[model samples]
Target: MGYIAFTIGFIVFFFVLAFLSTTFSIPADAMLPIGGLLLLVMIIAIAAYAALS
Candidate 1:
């Protein structure tokens, strides 16, 4: 259940980012670094969650 919630939240986060980028004319080049950071955070979060569980 917790994993499912986390997955849903992560998906929603990307969707929101996508919407904002399109609406605000955020450059794709700028988004690359931001996306990489988010991916790193997601990996760390999952690792921490698994360790705690």
Candidate 2:
């Protein structure tokens, strides 16, 4: 279902971000920009989904 896929994608998104951060030793200062970008992407995704549904 769409709901289940969305939930899984949300979890996977965070997991991949965490893994990449740890693997690359991302700096704290960079996190703000990265988080902002992710937030923007999330908002766009939710809005698009809502419009489609």
The best candidate by lDDT is 1
Off by over 4 Å in 2: 1-10
Q: Could you tell me every candidate's TM-score relative to the true structure?
A: 0.67, 0.66
Q: Indicate which candidate wins on TM-score.
A: 1
The digit string of per-residue lDDT tens for model 2 on 2-52 reads 576578768877887788788999986887788678867876786688678
Model 1: how large is the Cα RMSD against the reference?
Answer: 2.2
* Pairs in steric clash, model 2: none
Per-residue lDDT value at 11 in model 2: 82
lDDT of 1 by residue, 1-53 (tens): 56885897689779977986899889999888887888788778877877788
Q: What is the C-alpha RMSD of each candidate to the true structure, in Å?
A: 2.2, 2.3
